[model samples]
Every structure is written in structure tokens, then in C-alpha cells.
Target: MSELIELFKDPYERRARLVPALLVALPLLVPLVCVYGPRNPILTAVLGLLGGCGALYALASVARGRGKKLEEALVKEWGGMPTTIALRHRDSTALDSVSKRRYHEAFSSKLGIGMPTAEEEAADPARADDVYIGATKRLRELTRGGRNLLLKENIAYGFHRNMLAMKPLGVVACVLGLAYGLIIAKALQLAPLTFAPGKIAAPGLAAALTLLISLAFFVAWVFYFDKDSVRRVGFVYAERLFECLPSLQPTMPRKRTTKSTASSDGPD
Candidate 1:
């Protein structure tokens, strides 16, 4: 438990932003050059290079944003006492007794009050144990119920991570664009199709353009929708943790007893 607390105290490690950006841009540029040439293959290739750069820029932005958000959310949740306890025991009830006891001792000790005797401590690890189990139990239950909801958020975050990692949509767009350019160049070679007299490669060019546009839309969806899922999850978890804070603090009421006096009635 101490180790877990220590671990949560450390700053989070984030990946370099450059890596994902480079991956997205490199493949995307290949298709760009093939589609937009200056009638000179060399010049066309140069233009195509821009595609890679754009993809890289977009992917890098997504990765950096998601990574930062995830780190911040985790820190917020684990940095506090109540949230930390909830997360630490999100899985099992084994630590309930120990955690309750430790919290109780810490509270009493901090207030400069005498610690309960071993026998009294052993009698009930909860109420007398210094820590209130009712509140902890309530927190534990809230955390458990929220687990599935948080999991969905985690999964959404993961998908965004993969999108940043693989840059799949960007690669697909580049490939489709390249295919269309090649098809147009092939059709132009067979015979001059008089669509626009000079626009003989229109069909193939259109396909490639459509593919690039589709990829752009997909990327937007990933950024706006998928990324938001992770943020929402973090928000909910933080809120729940805050709700459990009162219970984490020990609230011991003073024990009160009444003294009785017997009255004598004139020898009855």
C-alpha cells in the first residue's frame, strides 16, 4: 500500500511527440506526389512529399493531446487520499481492514490523542478501529460500479492511442491516391479519352482525391469523438473520488455516559 502511494506520487512519463507525427507523414506523402506532378515525375514526387508532412503533423497533435490528458486525469485521481484508496482496492476487499486501521491510527495520532489499546483495537477494526468503514465501504462500492464506465473510457483512449501509433487511415489514403494516379496515367497511355480533352485521367484522379478526403474525415472523427471519450471518463472518476473524501477522514465522536443517583425515601 505504501508502495502504491509512493508510485502515485511520481510524475508521469510521456512519449515524444515527434514519433507519431513522423509515422503519419511518411506514408501519406508517397501518394501525394504520385497524384500531383508538374508533368515532371521529379517535381510530382516533390509535391507528394507534402502529404507525409501533413499526416505527421496531424498525428503528432493527436498523440500529444491524448497523452497529456490521460496523465493529468490519472494524477488527479490518485494524488488524493480517498481516490487513492478507491483505486488501490478497486479489485479486492483484502485491504479494507488494514486500510481502515491505518487511517484510524493516523487520524488519532495526528490529533495528539491516545491510541486505543490492543484489546480494544482487536475488538472491532472498524468504528473503534479509528477509521469509519461505512464511508470507505460506500466509496468502494461507488468505485466498483464506476469501473465498467471507466473501462469504456479507457478503451476509447486506447483506440485514439492506436490511431496515433499506426496512422492507418493516413496510410490508406496515400495508397488509394497513388492507385488512382497510376490508373489515370495508364488510361492516358492506352488512348486519348475525350472527357475534357486534357483531363483524360479524371476518373482515376477523382478516386484518389475521394480517398484522401475520406481519410481526413476519419482522422477528425478520431480526434473529436474518440479522444473526448477518455476525457469524460477521467472527469467522472475525479468527481466520484471527491465524493469519497469525507469518509476517508476519521470522524470520532466523544463517548458520553450518564451517572445515576439513588434516592432514599424515609425508610419506606
Candidate 2:
């Protein structure tokens, strides 16, 4: 698990993948922690074994996959990927005409290829796509250095995107925990971690309270998440990414390739 946990050193991995995994897993973890006091040797051993078994690694991977799938669907609903849409001559949702024109000028000058005209987009869309795709690639490379203006936006985008992706599962886990909490509190009349002055705390009430606490995840999903939220964050990231065009130093232009080299890359 240490090996897998180390992956979180990457901002995208932590904000976009691992944190969502942990939120979905929170319901189960909360009760366990409450039932066994935070200092319990038994709980610590269980976690160590679980961590060694790569459970956390698997969870993070699953969350990443789901988040990406959600992103794909949202792209369709929103008409295009944020960066791709912003660079298009016809799309005005992500950038104003003045800003888009400046973006076109910057990339065209830097890359030695014009942003495809609206007529070109209408006539041979793939050619236009190739131009936009190439510019996006360059933007990503350029954004990696300097102050990393784009990196911050990318992390913010990933955080919202992944959190939105795992929302249903997170909500379901919270619902189950809430039900269990009610059961323990009402039927069992147990106080999992109830403290009374110097008295030893019972584990039931605190455990139930932890379950209730998990519902905050559900409420947040309901109140804070939406497909538009992902799109908005993505566009912000895209703008910052493209904003790096001055970072591109001009060189002799290479011949165009026959193949459509454009491929989908995202903030994994």
C-alpha cells in the first residue's frame, strides 16, 4: 500500500482519484474507527494489513476510471471538451471573440499553423481538429513549467470532476451508514463512544455519530456537484493551459503527417 499511497504525491492523483476513493469508503471507516478507539492497536493492525493488501490502491484506480467515464459523457452533453471547444473558431462558450482571436494568433505564430478557419472547419473538420489538437498538446507541455498557472486549475478541475463522478456511490454509502446509525441508536440503545465525565466512553453512540457524520458527503454531493461544475473547472484549466503560448519558442515548421494524430488526453 505504501507503494500505491506514494502515487498521491501527484496532485492529480490525490485530488482527482484517491480522495474520492476515500470519501466513498468513509462510511465503513468511520464506524470502524469509532468502535475501536483511535489509539486501538487492533484497528491500527487492521489498517496496516489492509494498506499492505493494496485495497487503497484498487479503490483509487476504480475511482479514477469512473471519473474519466463521467467526463466523457459530460463532454458530449456540453458539445465538446473544454479545451477543444475553446480553441474552435465557432465556439463562444469558453472564450470571447477577442480572447479566442488572441489565442489563435499566439498558437499560430508559435506553432507555425493557423487556427483553422470557420470555412475549413465546415469543409474538412478533421483538418481543423488536427490543428486544435496539436495546439492543445503544446499548451499542456508549456503549462508544466514556470509558475504552473495551469497546474493549479488542473488540480481544482480534477478535484471537482472526481468528486462529482463518485457522488452516487458516496451518497449510497452514506445512506447505508445513516440507516445503520439509526438502528444502533434507536433499537440497540448503544453508545459507542458516549463520554460521561471520567466514565469510560461506550463505543455505540460515537460509532453512530460517525455514521451520521458521513452524511455530510451526501449533502455536499447534492448541493455542490453538477456536470456544469466539471465543465466550468475544465474551462478554467483550459484557459490557463492555452494562456502559456508565449512560452512556446518558434522553430522551423515540420511537415504535416498523414495520420490523424489527435488523441484524447485528460487530467488523470
Root-mean-square deviation (CA) per prediction: 18.8, 4.9
lDDT of 1 by residue, 1-268 (tens): 3432332342111124434444344434444444444356876655446434453345545665655555545445544222223323231332355654554454343322333444654574333322322333333433443445443433344344434444444556545544444455453333454233344335455444544554564555356434344344434443433334444444444231111121100000
Best by lDDT: 2
Go through the candidates in order and give each one's C-alpha lDDT.
Answer: 0.40, 0.72
Model 2's C-alpha root-mean-square deviation from the true structure amounts to 4.9
Clashes within 3 Å, all models in order: 5, 9
Residue 147 lDDT (model 1): 49
What is the model-wide C-alpha lDDT for candidate 1?
0.40
lDDT of 2 at 52: 76
Best by TM-score: 2
Clashing pairs in 1: 25-52, 25-56, 29-52, 32-48, 33-48
Summarize candidate 2's per-residue lDDT along 5-87 as a digit string, tens digits: 57666766776678888988788677767666476978779897887788778888888788778877886787667887888
Residue 188 in candidate 2, Cα distance off native in Å: 7.5
Residue 110 lDDT, candidate 2, scale 0-100 = 78
Residue 258 lDDT in candidate 2: 25
